[model samples]
Target: MEAVVFDGNKLKLSYEKNYPKPEILDDDDVIVEVHYAGICGTDLHIIHGEFPAIKTKPIALGHESSGVIHAVGKNSVYKVGQKVAIDPNKACNLCDFCHKGNYQYCLTAGINSTIGIWKDGGWAQYVRVPQQQIFALPDEITTEQAGLCEPYSCVSHGFNRASPLKVGERILVLGAGIIGNLWITTLHHHGHREVTVSEMNLTRLDIVKRLETGYRLVTPDVLAKENTTYDVIIDCTGVGKVMEISFNYLREGGKYVLFGCCPPAHTTSLNPFQIYNKELTIIGVKINPFSFPSAISWLKAMGSRYVDYHKLGVKTYALSEYADAMEDLKKGSVAKAVFKVVKD
Candidate 1:
């Protein structure tokens, strides 16, 4: 099987023609034939060595994916040929967090329990995952759309953290990358029309315009000069400077949702006095926690009406074009890039 392998060093990444195929490792494991795998910011972070705790040499890099079951263990409830979307987080059921039904914060699995980060994941033709990680995709959802389930789940989790969006609350989303755009779409799907998205990339802004999402798109420079404040501000750009500056745009009692993953060692300065005076809430969303089912359900309900997966600016590349995909992503030329691992 052909796979993109990252060997710890950023310059050591390569596409290999004969990567070993994955085999079912447990009675509850299932082997999936990956159809589409989406490249994520975390993948970029891994390449840049930002996430040292999860970095593993010679590992396949991709967690957002949709696939068909090629094989299943005897104990697995899923059948071969079942189309599914994957949740890459595998929890240690015995952990205190898991015992409390907060598996995303599982002490044992939360740090190093992701598929692409800690183990071989979907940047290949086949991947073997525990049966618990697979969610059956509705027949109406295309394989390409299913590839985005993981990201949508993250967006759902973020919304859960910032829930109770008032009837007419004004919202601002900083950054127009894949996750940011997903936030916009998800907000629109939930009937929040007064939303603004600030992004510096012209290509991404143009993509948002073409979606006809009614979102007010503005450059960061333009947004900086605006006097209006928002009830909720979500920073999807993990830059510490952007996050620090966004504080000025939040309403006094507003909430700030940190939906992006800044470097683990990075820090942003916040005034403790301002936090106390304004009574502001800072919300941090980790990875998806039991949000996959909600994401899939919402995607199925929307069915291209509220959220058109095709127009989400997904640029597809073949597995062999891994380098090109990474280059485009680095250049901010695409909102989302997916590897078409298998022909649909």
Candidate 2:
């Protein structure tokens, strides 16, 4: 099988023609034939040696993927040929956090326990994962859309952490990438009307405008000059400077949701006196935790019309085009990039 492997010594991924096929190791495992796999920002971080603590060398690099079951173990509840979305997250059931239903924070295995990060994942024709990590996709959800499940689930978890978006409260999303746009769509789906987006990329800003999502778009420079504030501000850029500046736009007593993944070594300074005086809440979202089911349901309810809007500026490439896709992503030419592994 052809696979994209990260050897940990280089800054780029290597495509191999004869990667080993996955075999079912445990009774609760399933082997899936990957159809579509998303290229995430975290993947770039891993390739650049940002996540040295979690990443293992020579691992297949993909976590957001959708596929069909190629084979299932005897104890697996899933059947062969079942279409599913990969959750990627795995946790030790015995952990204290797992017992409290906060599995993403499980002590033994959590974010680092994800598929592509710590183990061989779906950047190939086939991947073997535990049965509990696969979620059956509804008939209405296409394989391409199913590839978005993992990212959408992460956004859902972020929203849950910053809950209770009251009526008439202004909301701002800083960034127009895939995760930021998903936050806009999810907010719209849930009936939040007053939302604004801040992005420096004019191309992405135009894409959001074309969708007619009714979101007010502005450049960071313009937003900073306007002296505008939001009741809730979400930072999805994951830049240290942006994270530090985002606090200026948050209202007193408002919530600041950090949904983006910053480099582990990057550090930003915050004022303790402001946090004390404003009584502001700074919430950090790790990854999806018990939110995949709700994300799927929400996607189904929103239907293709909305999903198609989210798909704008998204480009798909074959597994052989991984280098091209990564180049495009690094150039900020595409809002989202996916590798079409199978013809589906």
Error of 2 at 18 (Å): 0.9
lDDT of 1 by residue, 1-344 (tens): 98988787543578998999998879999999999999988888778878753433678878898899999998999999999998998678887888887887886685467887778889999999999999998898887788889989988988988988875899999999888888888887788899999999999998887667788999999988889999999999988888888887888899999989888877889988888988899999989988999999878876776455557778999989988988999899888889999975
* Per-residue lDDT of model 2, residues 171-198, tens digit only: 9999988778888888888888899999
Clashes of each: 0, 0
- For model 2 the local lDDT of residue 295 reads 84
Q: How close is candidate 2 to the true structure, as a TM-score?
A: 0.96
Clashing pairs in 1: none
lDDT value for candidate 1?
Answer: 0.86
Query: Each prediction's Cα lDDT score?
Result: 0.86, 0.86
